[model samples]
Target: MLPNTLAQEMPRALQHLLAREEQTDMTTLPRRSFLKLAGAGGLALGLYPSLASAQAPAAAGLKPFEQPTAFVQIAANGDVTVTINRLEFGQGVQTALPMILAEELDADWAKVRSKHGSNNPAYADPLFGMHLTGGSTAIKHSYTQYRELGARARAMLLTAAAARWNVDVKTLRTQAGWVLGSGGRKASYGELAEAAMSQPVPEKVTLKNPKDFRIIGKPTTRLDAKAKSSGRQNFGIDVQLPGQLTAVIARPPVFGAKIASLEDGAARAVPGVKTVLRVPLDRGAEGVAVVAEGYWQAKLGRDALKLQWDTSGVEKVDSEKQLAQYRELAGQAGPRHFDADMAPLANAPHTLEAEFVFPYLAHAPMEPLNCTVQIGDNGAELWVGSQMPGLDGMAAARVLGFKPEQIKVNVQTAGGGFGRRAIATSDYVVEACTIAKATRAAGFNVPVRTLWSREDDIKGGYYRPMHLHRARIGFNAQGQVLAWDHTLVGQSIISGTFFEGMMVKNGIDATAIEGMREPYPLPMRLTVHHPKQNVPVLWWRSVGSTHTAYVMETLIDEIARATKQDPVAYRMKLIGDKHPRHRAALQLAVEKSSYGKKALPQGRAWGVAVHESFSTVVAYVVEASVKEGKPVLHRVTAGVHCNLAVNPRTVEAQIQGAALMGLATCLPGAAITLKDGEVQQSNFGDYAVPRITDMPQITVHVVPSADAPTGMGEPGLPPLAPAFANAIARLTGKTPRELPFKLA
Candidate 1:
């Protein structure tokens, strides 16, 4: 695989692509078929060339994202349908994205609708040239792409109206889906669709200025809100195909363990059971696939099957032992990422040393993994909610022994993915394809939907890597840092994946130490250790910021407290003017939350932390108290600097959800552990997730700007835990050393 930079950089690459399109070539038709299909008087959703980049080669044609025929379809009744390229799990891309296109198109808000796209090359990220929804890049990267598409389409409609009315194109203006011309002559976009679509695709189009934006910055309700709240949304798991069969697997007890023997007589005898076959699983393991007419039937068949696993060669991966090993590794220097002078470490007026432990965490999406595969003699089609549809399609084709183009992936709305559905290895998709193929070989050539129970999902691996952070700092009475040394020990999420080449440098994973000494110019020596582990690991919601931000911000707070300084003012002084976004966000939070001026109710104390991730910055000011030995967060005030919030409602909702997820990390029992090669927690009963009762009243505010928006999803998460921890530290003299806050 070719090396690719991280996802957050995608939008900057788009600027280069647009630079080439600046020289308009209006004579060239994007594709011959697009015109022919338009002449045939039907809606055409044809493919366009990809935007060329270092990692993504172009197809030598008009850019797919610049064409409106593929993304927008105007019905006769003026209903504008926009197809989003990224998966909409819970981020509100379905509505937030359409609001972008519709803004430039000047379409009526009520008439606009949105839908998910497929694995088509045209739907791949304009810059990344890959199907991706992670890293919070959806809105950030595609904002300008969709704007140009809408502008070009609107321009075409104006051109068509000018020709029809026998006037200059410049004389016509568009408003709310209508092309308005002189003498009260006007036509709806739907009325001019066929004629306008046949017009040559423009290589150059003007974008609306931020001052003129009618839809971009407005706080609007999500397009899917009513359906979702009304229980009318059809998620991937709700898919039903004719004669479709459901399949469930009995996985190995340990990672990489194989099936020793399987007794399937009782399973095959179960009602509604069609077949049972032992199949290959991810990570070189083996499991028995039970195929039946329904989910319950398949589950019953899987339960009845008597299976044995080979744990002889697999690693048991005891949690306590792994933590001990990580701690040992932390003391040894392997690779240095940041080198700074440590001469002042031993001579400083004051010094502090702290070690923090974070355990493995499961994604635990609300919808357990499920994929529907229908195989034909020549090709196959898959229906699933995937974060990486192109990669998933390729994995399916590889497993089915077919060409990539022969497989079709119909991306669907997901309940919630967090990060599980975006697996780099395509583990769950590959497993589903393998099971479908095995079922076909057993004389059942039908569509099969593979489902994982809640237990299976919780116990299934690919957890956020367990991590250990050790930091030693030297400072003065003024809270000025003299020297700092930090070490991080964790499994590299990119070590074995294709990203290893680009993200891992000189034995250190960039992701493992991403948020170290950022915003503040601290003289720090940072060392990293990437130890190979048997446990399957992947990126969580905020990636490395999950632990790094907690360590950095809480330590910063500690230093401020030790020196008799205000946490907010100390952070401001350290950040200075180098990071204006961070300063703006922190200031916004302080002002909104009344951080320094207002005194909280007797027990409550103010906590402050600011962090930047995925190019977005979020500062949180929280009020917290210790209630009967546990920390209780009463409220949260967030100040976000994501440039421009295309939809403030979406931005606010994202912060709310991210803050809640961050809070879940502090709740008791919120961990995944291993013992004797088996997962100790199977479901919500043992492994904890935040309940409604644990929710804190959250208020979100954004530092507004006209610049393009940055990522909002992951950035909101990194600062939440640290701010909450700081508040707890104020209430109690001791700072929490680990997550899930083991308060006594």
Candidate 2:
């Protein structure tokens, strides 16, 4: 079955090549037939090259190079369709990836449309050879791959035009979907599509110089902007197939708790309720599913169900108790990430010790989790806003007792993910598949759409791990660091996962200590403790950088103030020109924000912080004030150094959105707390995310560079909180020791 599917997966270019290879006498073929079927005429939808791994070596009776069938497609109407390998969860890859391919194809941008890809092996990440969209790597990894695809497609079209015009291909150039020949003879790509199918796929082509770029690096609007703005864009939550049933699960209130007994008499009596059954949940837990005709009915049935839970062995994590445990752990050193002698701390001229606490945070994507699963005799199909479709598909296969290839996972456009959609556990997908399997067992032949209400999503186990940082610093009178010892205590997000082998070493998770003691030459000793907690924790937006950056930047500012030196100037001196990117980004923000040149309004202070995460450096200079004992961030000026911004508009939007989320950390009710082993906050009423009223006046500036672009999505967030803290500290003359600063 897999072998037959592999053959069907070949792209049009490879199909034509394979057909030519089978011909014994080429001269016997008709001339018109050669012209029509030689290249890509009538290229079937599934005719693109097979997965890169499936395309064996030339010695293995397969092509030496994989073809570009999965990514690029040209319709008869001249609409250029480019398939994005990454999920478009508000990061603008739908527009940016198309821009990359269209720029090289010389296709009319106005005619370009983007599509989200599925779990095809061909859509795997170029670097990891897996389906993923996290670490902000969508653009960074696929930039060259997409460009080459466009170039290859354009070369084929040009060859066809040259043949039709009876001229050398070298004399033809493409522009805006047209091939121009000498003496103004031109042909639209649509007119040459049938003949161009015969052109050989080029293994190598010259990429355009940055100076010659007409589309990339320009500020282009998002391709899905109109559809999304007009409320026509279909998200995973919006998927409604025929004969589909809605499912709502009633999970245990305590993490890892199981249902001991159930009473579903009233639930089954509901008007549209179909059946109620127990199912397996993530992390060895159990849940009850309420299947019905629609979401509202399923939800009502779920609310009507009565059950008894057994949480005897489960750990009931209390936020206050957890903080006490962390403080005790911080007092003793754990495994060391960096080693330095602490002898200087005993007799240092100036010393400061501070402990910072950060609580768990929910991803709270605008669209709560949902997965639509359709089961048939031969296989099953899944539709979800998946960041890791390959993993999700495999999980579904396991749940349904089918082969991995038997399940098709369709990645859908999402409202926002941050880092929740991409999980090591594939929890949501598995839950959906479980419900589907149970529905089938109950003799229901309809598709099952599992939906998570906002309350369920917020209370879900996977969250950004709560963290505690203890820093003991000793510095000279001039703000020169003498010795720094830092201890971090948090649950290991990758300790027992599949990524542990690669991401964890020496009992320390690299993600737990990513942004420590860099860009500044501090003789620092860093220690980390990974406590096994019942709570499920995953990487947040910027991972460890979220808290590490805040701790480092705020402490540095405090040391500068103690020594009576300008904060920005002290930062420059410590930076010492080793990291030019950090320096440039910081300088740009200071210059653009007029940090020292202009006087701020009374009661307002300028706060500055800079940090690098995901290979991008971001600096924020903000105006903040303490109004009635609450910190209010008035305005923000950001200098971003993500190298070349593929689309400045996307970059700006990302920075603005990320900055707003960062401000959310400073607002009152931002932290997720656990009481008696249950998530205390279930919805926005208690878990406060930033509203439009909390937004500040923001200006984002990009440093001009031709260097390859890094990630922009997560970098903007890590600095905003620290910058705001620095401003509030100036007004109160006291440092903030925890998130959502407590001022009395």
Candidate 3:
């Protein structure tokens, strides 16, 4: 439930718009007559002469700036406001989405303002049926709709200008918010604002061709770059509301443990401590929150408290033990399978089989998880950076025993999501709500803001589950690959109660079986999934593709080695020649990296890997050398096939960022585990991320196509790990089957 003030303010804000509309004389008038009347009304109301020039409305009485997904409003003072409904979580969506709309509207970019829209079905994505942003689908989903929106507004403005000047719209063109006629008569959009506002929306709007686009494909700087660089951009951790108290929780030491009792004598005596309460942990997890005036005080209070935990069930859970169990499971023949064949090879052929292991990983976002909740008599108000607002709203409503409408979720910019922010049950948000409710029950009227320390966040169990993959491939004497058999042992991403009804036939989780079932043209390819139930796992950056791509690409390298053929040539042979983009990326990466030319000094070698994910094809040529028993990356040359980039600069940045992130993860970073199911690595001092000194010189090449824009965020990540592993194998003459590859 949201605070009464915010809940009460919403209807008033909506009613204000309705009242403003009712004040206008909106009786049915012909399109032409409506514009003339609006222009006359503007002139009579003492509007600037620049705003009194325009013609009539379009058919159906549609307004110029109205859009199904977003709306644009132009004020009399030349302020152009564009509303975006999608969440911007370090993906540059705040800048990119508006660029599409502003390019079509021909609005002055310098004067444009971006605002986030409320959660409504009007803003729902047509493909997903929800107003959500994930799976790298932001730009791809809104590309066409935003363009149409901008084009419609442009047409209406042009129509209004033609009517005012008694000239044909065909002879007029718009640029920088001004409409210009054949003879050089020019009128600013503000001059034609009222008449344009009265114009009807176009039934069929044509989009600009690629060559004619001045802004869509250009490399414009990110709109929020300045704010972010100047430390003014507010993420979830930076949110602070009036009279908001801070809170910190003490969680159990083991998974699924229960809290026995708490000795809060020291916590209650801590300075600035407001309240210490033992709240029931959601989802059967253990924790107690300590509320205080500030985060430091809350932390001190939480640390001072003594608590006992009952770790009866999960005391023996260990990663090494889990890995051994998974290996045992992978050895068994499974009935629930997709595209897999585990039988012995039939014809005269060469076969290669190996098992790969990937450890569990944590998201470890920079800002950590934080949320501010204020519950009042009317409803509940929550200020947080949530990836799934609807889901968060429902969860808050359920905990507070109120209707979903009673909760108001104020979405904020996230430091980084990477699927961590979409936790079905937000522990931070729920804790804050509970604190607020507890305070209200105590007659204190104080809201609570829960903040999870970096340690707390790292210890949470929303990790990318450890996976075991066993694979075998057979190649004929002609060097043609004939059969592929793969079995994956990992936790099901969609098996939990939250996703109870989303399971497909035989309870197969598509996320866990992503890259295992490729669409390649193979003679006999079989993939099987053996779901592991004990460990808790969730989606990470690339989801299943993260490990699956590594396994598949590494297996291909092994096949190429056995066939005694060039790796690039072998992959090119297997892939379809008709896929020009895929072939082009492969060719470019190989040619640029001098794939088969020569080996570098110091026993260095280069390895090539190509993969397609998120509708984008990418190829990587990684150069590596074993120096003093350590794999040192020298250079990485990549070719990216992202169809029709909305912003080429953003696409390049995303590729560069993804490559660095993948390199960091590939080098050495997994959530280290203890024998009692507790995380050992808790902070950056122990958990390493890629630094400037460790970065290799990276070259990214984009293969352009006029095809629709595909995903750019995760596609660049899938190739790095496998490419590096193949390079390591070539250098050491041993297959690097496990992640966090260590050289001997």
Candidate 2 lDDT, 336-398, residue by residue in tens? 988899899999999999999999999999999999999999989999999888778777877
- Please list the C-alpha lDDT of all candidates, in the order they appear: 0.85, 0.84, 0.71
Which of 2 and 3 is ahead in TM-score?
2
lDDT of 2 at 133: 84
Over the full model, what C-alpha lDDT does candidate 3 score relative to the true structure? Answer: 0.71
TM-scores for every predicted model: 0.93, 0.92, 0.87
Off by over 4 Å in 1: 1-61
Relative to the unseen true structure, what is the C-alpha lDDT of residue 139 in candidate 3, on a scale of 0 to 100?
78
Candidate 2, residue 505: the lDDT equals: 71
Sort order, TM-score high to low: 1, 2, 3
Give the Cα-based TM-score of candidate 2 against the true structure: 0.92
Better of 2 and 3 by lDDT: 2
lDDT of 1: 0.85
List, residue by residue over 533-552, the lDDT tens digit for candidate 3: 44456778877788878887
Model 3, position 341, has a per-residue lDDT of: 48
Return the top candidate by TM-score: 1
